[model samples]
Structure formats: C-alpha cells, structure tokens
Target: MSSTEHTSLAPVEDDARLPVADPGLGEHVERYTDTDPAAARRAYRQVVTMFGLVPLLAIAFVVVYFAVPQDLWVPLLGTHWPLNNLLLGLTGGLAVLLVGLGAVHWARQLMSDHEMVEERHPATSDAATRAAFAEKVNAGVVDAGVSRRGMLLGSFGGALGILAVPALVTLADMGPWPTAAVRRETIEKTLWTEGEVVVNDVNAKPLRPEDLEIGQLVNAEPASLFDLNGHDYLTEKAKSALIVVRMDPNRIQIPESRRDWQVGGILAYSKICTHVGCPITLWEQQTHHVLCPCHQSTFDLGNSGVVVFGPAARSLPQLPLRVNAEGYLVAQSDFTVPVGPSFFERDSRNDYQEGDQ
Candidate 1:
C-alpha cells in the first residue's frame, strides 16, 4: 500500500475531554499512639515538657542579659571567654530551638495522622470555597485537641509570648544619648595625667630622651596603663598609645607656646589616626611625617603634627612632654584636646592648629 493510504488507515481517537480516574490514597498505617491511649498521653506529656523548657530558657536569657557584665571573662578550655555572650547565646538559642521542636513533636505524635491528597484546581477560589477552607481550619484545630489540651496550648502560647522579651530587653542599650559629660568620662578620656611617665610599649620600661635618637621613632604608652587589667587595660591603652619622635633642634618648627612642651627636641603625638582612629605606625625620618597605614593619612610631626596629606581633617593630637626628676620622659598633663576621631560633643575650636603659638 502507498504511504498516504497507510497513514489514513491508522486508527483515530475522538478529541473530546474525558473524566480522570481516581488514584486512591495508599493503605494507611496506624501509629502506636493511634492504637494505644497510653502512648498518646505519653506523647502529649513529652510535647508539653519540651514547650515548658522554652519559658525557663527565655527567663534565663533575660537574667544573663542583665546580670552578667559584658566584660566578665571565664576560663573555658584553656581560653578566657565572655561569660555574658556565651550564656546569652546558649539560653536564647535553646529557647527558640525548643519551641520549634515542641511544635514538631505535637504535630507528629498527636495531630491528625490520616493521609490527605489535594487535586489540582483553579488558582482563584470562590466565596463558598474560601468559607469552606476557613471551616476546615477550625475543624483541623479541633482535631489537634487544642481546646481539650489546655496545658499544651498554654505552654506553647507562653513560650511564644515570652520569647520576645530577650529581644526587647536588649533595646535598653540604645539609650539616653551620649551627652557632653558622658563623652568626657568615656571615649574622650585617657589615662595620661601630669607626671605620668612615658614607657616603651614593647618592653614596659620608662623612656628617657636618650633612649630615642634624632630621626628615630618609638611607640610608647603611659606607665600607669600597665596597672590596669582586662577591659580597663584595653580601653586605656587604645587612647593612651603614643609615638615619641625626635628631630634636630634646628630642623623643626617649635611654636613659642609649646617650647617647653618638648624635651631636647623630642616630641610625642597620639598613635591613633584622626580620620577613623587607626594606629599611626609608618614613619618617614627625613620628612618627620608619620602615616596611617589604613587610609594613608599623613601627619608632619616636625610641624605640630599637622595633616600634610590624605583624608584626616584634624592633626594628630600632640602630647605635652617634659623631663621628670628621674630624667625620664613624662606627660605634663592630659592631652590639650580629646584624641582619636572627632565626635558631635567635642569642641573642635580648641583643637591645636599648625600656626597656633
């Protein structure tokens, strides 16, 4: 037969839509709790117990949040750890974890276990379908025994409600706004005071004029800084860190007002950069300029620590230096102005200028 005749002879089916055959759900397997009343009650207790722990953890989170100092450290596994953070994380994390676990346990062991199959339908629902869906939700809640199991419902609700407390209580840290007085008492203040001996930061020995040669720089800090421990030591050291540099007496400009501020052509400036409070470490001996490696802010130490280049808006704060009775370098007083980065409360007008005498 010809190919066209052969194709026409093939059987043809009608193009009418037909009803789909139902693929019934597979045989249901009964759970141990479904068959035994005692097992169901035991599951209820287990779920309730898990939910009950969440509230206790939440309370612990709050207690750890306030009672433990952030700086308090405890020895753990050969290293000191922040007790506040460790405890807070443990309590808060477990609180959330228990809530999730409790819900899962309740659904698996106690909720309706009958298998359900949803057939595809139109995306949009009519008013009747929507109303029916809401009724089904109410029925599902009843099947979960929410009304009958008051203890389970109460524990779950309490756990969920109290979980908000840890987050809310921490908001207290956002607080009363840093006033001028607060600035003076905290970040603006350092350990330096009159007669505080300058010490080599590396060796912790008091430094003298002879310890530094002309065109040489040494990183130093207040001798009193060594007396502090833990957070106090770290806080003070950040603000009190200094760099002592020396140049030829005839080579650098010394303002008449600051003539007595230096000792034998040696001077000291804050090791912190003004731009973003990075430590100033890189030094140029010939130019007498110290550079901040972070943003390349350069300060001319020979000319009152003026900003010769880069993004620093203010000069590196100079520390007034003098010789003590023991012939060691000592601070005349605290810095004339606050050091490090500027803040809203600071009086920038009082900051040292290049031409100020």
Candidate 2:
C-alpha cells in the first residue's frame, strides 16, 4: 500500500458490536488484601482505627474549649497567637479530617476493586426502571460492608454529636436582658441633676462663662461623675457626657421657650448621636455642626440640636444649662427628652415636669 493509503479489514459481527470488533477491558490484577484474608482484615482494622480516632479528636475539641484560657498567647512568626483559637481549630478540623481519611482508606483497600461500566440509557426512564435503580443503590450500600462495620458507625455518630456542645455553651455569653427600670435608668436618664457642675472632660475642672471662647466646643461631663464608684462612674459619665459649644449670641437660634437653657450663648447637648448612639465630637465651628464619626450624622448645636443632615432621625437631646452661684456652668436639670437612639418600647414623653427645678 502507498504511504497515504490504508487497507480496510472485514467487519466482525458479534453481540451488541458495531461494524467493528470491540477491544475489551484490560487484564484484571487483584490486590494483596483481596487475595489474602489476613491482609484484608489488617486493612479493615487500619480503616476502623482511623475512624476510632475521630471521636478522640472530637473530645479533645471539647476539652480545649473549656480548659484553654482565651487571653493566653504564644509568640510565633513575630506575633502572638491565641492558644484557645489554635487548639479549637486543630481539634475540630482533625476530627473531621480523620473520618474522611478512614472512609477513603476503607474504599481503596478493603472494599471491592473491580471496575464496571454501563451502556447509555434513556434520560427519562419508566417507573419500574427507577425502582430497579433504587434497589441497586441499596445493594451497593450493602456491598460496601457498612452494615457489618458497627465500630465505624458508632464512632462516627459519637464524633458528630459532640461537635454541638461548644456552640451551645458559648451562647451563654450573650448576657441577660435588661429589666424595665434598668433600661430607663441606664439609657434614658443621666447623672445630670439640678446645678451639677459642667466639668471639662480632660481636666475635670468646672467651666465658667469666661472659660469658653466664641465658637469653642468642649467635650464635658457632669461633676457628679467624680463621686460615683466602681462601674457606676464609667456608666454615668458615658450617659452624662456633653459638648459645650459657644457661638455669637446674635448668630445662635434659641427658641422662645428654651431661652433660659443657655448661659451667654454657651449651650450643652449630648455628645452621643441619636443614630445608633455613636460618640460625636467632630465639630465644624463655622457651620455650627457636629458630625458622628461612625455614620456621619450631622446635628446643629447652635439651634435646638436639630438634625441638619445625614441619617439622624431625631434632634440631639439638649442638656439645659445655667450659670450657677459660682459663675460655673451647671446643668439646670436632666434632659427634657430621652437621649440616644430610638427603640420600639421607649417612653418618648418628657419626664421632666414643669416645677421639677
């Protein structure tokens, strides 16, 4: 034959063959475990041993969750690593990993090594055909020898069950719900009482009218904050914090009813924003605006602390100010309205009655 020409051979007719002789599968070679019963038993033991360790690792996860101190750290890679997080991740991850490796080892050595293929069938089969497929699946599960592997099944169940304990135990850290009085006293009211001296937040000294310059904004807190002890000091100081800003008396907009709330154009409003209660000390003296650093909700302190821009829904709660007997700026009383962010069940009524001063 020429180099470009090919000879055609006579087609052979066989069962389910096309116009050609089929080249079938390769010669089968058995594994050592398949031929020797002892080797097969050893490999099965190896797989079961791997699965058995999964439960031990899972138990270690529980131990690490409770025993390891969260603040404890170790130096590595020029930085400290949290021992609690490290141990928890290792124990939990190794538990799942051991189970996967055991199942893979069992399939490779002890399970059936024979290879088979099926001819293409119709995409949508009859009900009888689907029923036959389901039966084949059940038969395959039985052939995989899981039905006789009681140790693997028990250990797998035990390992998976212990995984839930860590998550459920950590749920206790969310803390208890606030009582009605605790909610009102903590968030709605502050330490500001009648004639409570307005002190500088930095030096803790009282602010006189002469101490403030025009367009000056100072972060302030109630002088009563000095008398409180323990957690009450921080808690009351946070709620009673103020921004005392002085603007030109003619330039400021003081509503007719709240005229006495100012001391020579020096007014104090809450340092906390009504939008999610972020600390707002970002002052724009020229525009008379205070911006929340978290969400950029702007409020006009020169006005009645009105919401001039951004996402703030309500006006900043104004703390009524008065010049006391010592010429020191003092709070006339607590805020007339609730301070901070709004909630569904908050009592919005002004709790400060007319003669409370």
Candidate 3:
C-alpha cells in the first residue's frame, strides 16, 4: 500500500483497533573496557583477583576448622560467641560470595556488551534449526572470551576446586570411628560411680529412701555432677539424671538379677526416654508408669522400667542403688547399660520380658 493510504487507515484516538507502541532498543554505548585494550586488561585482572581471593578464603576455612578449639568462646556484641563457628562461617561465606561476585563482575566488565532481542517462536524446532542453535552457542562462548583467558580459567578452577576441600576436611569431624572403646568411654558411661550419692536435682540434697513415699517420684542426679561446670555439667547430667520412685514391694515385679538394685521399695532409673532421649516426667502413680512428655513413651517403673507402650525400643537403664553408712541413697555403680536413645552400638538384648534374666 502507498504511504498516504497506510496513514489514512491508521487507528484514530480511542479506536478499538489501536495497537501498542513498540519501544525499540536504545542506542548502544561502548564501555571503557570494550573500547580500550588497557581497560579490558584491568577488568580481566579485577575478576581474576576476585577469583584468586576465593581459594585463599577456602584455605582459611580449613585452617580455622583445625586451629580453633570448639569450646573457645569470645565476646561479641553483648554475648559470648563460639570462636570456631564464627571464623568458619566468615571464611566459608566469603569464599562462596567471592565466586558469585567474580562471575557477575566478569559478565558485566569483560564479556560481550552488544544486546539483541530473542523473538518467541514455536517450542519445537526442526533438526536444522537445532544444529544452528548449537553453532550459535559455540559462537557465544567465543564472544565471551573464556577459552582464551588462561588466568581467569585457572583462577576460577582453583577457587572451585579448593572450595570442595572445606567439605572434604569436615568429614573428619564424623570420625575416629566410634569404636567400642570410644563408645564405652563416651556414650555408654556416665558420671555415676560406686558410692556416688543420688541427690535431689532441685534441692541438691542427698536422697534417702524415706524422702520418697509410695507412688512418689523424685528427679535426681549424681552428686558428682555438682563438681562439673558449663558443658561438662550438662553433658554428665543428661546421661546420669535419674527418677527415683517408691512403689509397693508387693505390687512390683523385682527381677532376680536386679533384686538388690533397689533399696527397700525405692528404685532409681534413668530419666531419659529410650526412644529419642526425651525426659520421662509425667507420672502415673497407681500404675507405676512414667511417661515421656515429648513422645508419650511410657515405662513401667513398677516392672523394671520396661517399655509398656509407645515407640520406646529398650527398657530404661536402672541404677544399682544402696544406702550409704549415712543412710542416704547411693549408686552402687554406673548404669549397667547406656541410658538414652538406642545407638548403632547399643545391644538390643538389653530389652527384657518379665521372665528373662
């Protein structure tokens, strides 16, 4: 059609046929790096420098992982901070941040500056178009100048390779391989020992058989736990904490093997649930059952602390109890078995029925 005829057919104001105006790409301006070789070299160096710092930060992460003692605390803000965690986080975070920043900086400062719009087309492409698209990708890579820049390639590769070391070295934290000796020295034993008095956890006073009446339950811990401070106190208390309960001797079943483990009708058992280490706090006086509030695992305190209901797999570990010369309850020895949730090394045979020894 002629230009005048096209102008005459163009939609007027408020016409339903009015089309949206196309905002064409604006003028392209050359960057300093794009125009000058010296500027381009400097931009390349900046990105390489960023990538180079990532490897150093990664190395620092590993060094901090080994050098910093886990228990060492430093004051930060108004509170104490774990120095090991602080240093590791700082170094590891910087390493990852530098990698991302370096890629962004490289794309903006050193890669292609020309802009082109991609038109939407059918989703399925013919085989010839697919081949052409692959060629275009290769051409784009050439335009990016990645294959030609040895320093950028090497520095980026080194950064990513060194970053993996942090994860690999941390695998060491999982080991020394939880051998039988390590298990025995650690998870299998507690602060409770022969002659260690069982003290009421709240009052911190020695517990006597008379202190607990029938159907009464008292939360108790080893007297030796008071000697420890901070982490040691919590750690020992978690393993050695006990619930002392007194039941009618005629009503409860006393296993032949554990006959002397209780003093009179008072028995001491680990307060920790065998299912997932929740504390057994809810008490059923008449039934002599103690419930774990966290998961509702019930243990029959009247019948050797066996699992009477819920998901608990093993019976609660019983503490051998006897009266000292002073008439206060004392532990005859550490618990015969591990007390908390079942572990890989835990003996399932510890679970017993009424007739089993």
> Top TM-score: which candidate number?
3
Give a tens-digit lDDT track for model 3, residues 1-357: 866664436655754555766677888889999889999998898899999999889889988998889999999999999999999999999999999999888889887888888899899999999999999899888777888787877887898889999989988978677889988998898988999999999878998888889989999998888988988999888999899999999999998888999888999999999999998889999999999998888889888988888998888889999999999999999888888999887776766665665
How many Å off is the CA of 195 in candidate 3?
1.2
- Each model's Cα RMSD: 5.0, 8.0, 6.1
How many angstroms is residue 4 displaced in model 2 relative to the true structure, after the best TM-score fit? 29
| Model 3: how far residue 225 lies from native, Å | 1.9
TM-score, one value per model: 0.84, 0.63, 0.90
Candidate with best lDDT: 1
| Tens-digit lDDT string for candidate 1 (157-185) | 99899899988987887865679887888
lDDT of each: 0.90, 0.81, 0.88
Order of quality (TM-score): 3, 1, 2
lDDT of 2 by residue, 191-281 (tens): 8899889999988999999999998999999987888875678788778889999999898788877889998899999998888988999
| List of clashing residue pairs for candidate 1 | none
- What's the true lDDT of residue 127 in model 3? 98
Model 3 pairs whose backbones collide: none
* Model 1 alpha-carbon drift over 4 Å, by segment: 1-24, 65-86, 120-133, 171-177
Candidate 2: C-alpha RMSD to true structure equals: 8.0
